[model samples]
Target: MTTKATTDDTAVRTSVRVDAAPEHAFEVFTAGMDRWWTRAHHVQKGELKEIGVEPRAGGRLWEENDAGDVCTWGRVLTWDPPRTFAFSWLIGPNWQIPAEDAAGSRVTVTFTPTDTGTLVELVHDGFEVHGPGWEGVRGGVGSDGGWPAGLRQFAAAL
Candidate 1:
């Protein structure tokens, strides 16, 4: 969750075209998140029941497990429907919320209508906060098994 120096390599951005309208794309990304997001991405130790982003500004992005335990990953920063969405990603290296703002990051997703469907773009920034520990987190999120993989799953679900 560390913020990195504002550089191209520091910000993890990915875009995918989905076979749905902008509104439907937004719904699947937010309201229907649990159906697409993978349990393997959870930092929890039990079976995951759901992972959701509350559909409003300031709402929490959280995960609930079969054991009834909940963990919050971030908070919604903006809630523009069928277009743009942004949130604070506060989880840190130890899989816990950062104690200070400098240790957290931001994630913004945009949905734009195209000839075929909607183009969903995700940008994960602010990794400089981790100071020396930034690279590992960036690699994890940008790797084949990270956000790209998750988005692929999301598109397939749609």
Candidate 2:
């Protein structure tokens, strides 16, 4: 079963269960990021070679391509091992970064132990600050190719 709740108007939330220990799940989600995160969702100029979450507070979540160009998606906000991970995701309007101003949203992922394995909860919020074009960004995230596909890939990797 999947449950989605929207809080504060534009925020989106989703949860999925994975058949793995919380430690393993978190490791795969963060460390093994490149193995699951879809390439189509990124905003980069060159072909992507690697994508990863830099596992610490204030660290960068980045995607690097074959041309040695790096595009940073956000900064890690919270990094609690095997439990919670949060970051600011800034892809800007229509997946394009602003030349002068960058507006970002927040995504938080939590891992909970369960009888079967682990429960992964994701929350993407803070859209109001993205300004007028926020609706487009919000819609994309709730679309088929967004969290649903991303979580499916993540679960499959486990």
Candidate 3:
């Protein structure tokens, strides 16, 4: 994996290679998210049931718990199959959902065809939109347990 984040960069960037074609890789990331997402990163209490993207711009990025409660991670901002996807990240720095009026971060992921497989790149930015504790929010997402860990799990799943 390659991390492009620097102390001065506003975004957390990382990428990995997945042993699959762009189309297959994109499907696994969108429709098959639950298969690779870390259960330890569950957004709510109790068991995680599923995590998924709704497959279109303005659609939902959500997770459902075993108790049948569903949490919206955010709304999908861009959704071009076999290429790229972007979404809002609504969960706050405190690990809790904020009010409806609160601002959220943005995450963009792209898949490119490669000689051996697909090169998946992810960039998480817009932390300043969160206001007061924006730095903490940035740090948390830039951590190893954030995008890095998720990408590793994702690549290994394929």
* Model 3 Cα lDDT, one tens digit per residue, 32-54: 88999988777778888888888
Q: What alpha-carbon RMSD in Å does predicted model 3 have with respect to the real structure?
A: 1.9
Candidates by lDDT, descending order: 3, 2, 1
Q: What is each predicted model's overall lDDT from 0 to 1? A: 0.79, 0.82, 0.83
- Which residues of candidate 3, in runs, are more than 4 Å off? 1-8
What TM-score would you give candidate 1 relative to the actual structure?
Answer: 0.88
For candidate 1, write residues 1-158 as lDDT tens digits: 01111226768887888778999989888998998997777867778888999889989888888898887878899999999999987766666534545356788999989888988888988876667767677777777677787788788878
Give each model a TM-score: 0.88, 0.90, 0.91
Number of colliding residue pairs in each model: 8, 0, 0
Off by over 4 Å in 2: 1-8, 98-101
- Candidate 2 lDDT tens digits, 46-132: 677899988899898888888888878888999998999998878766786433346678999999999989999989988767778
Report how far residue 66 has shifted in candidate 2, in Å.
2.5
**Candidate number with the higher lDDT (1 or 3):** 3
TM-score of 3: 0.91
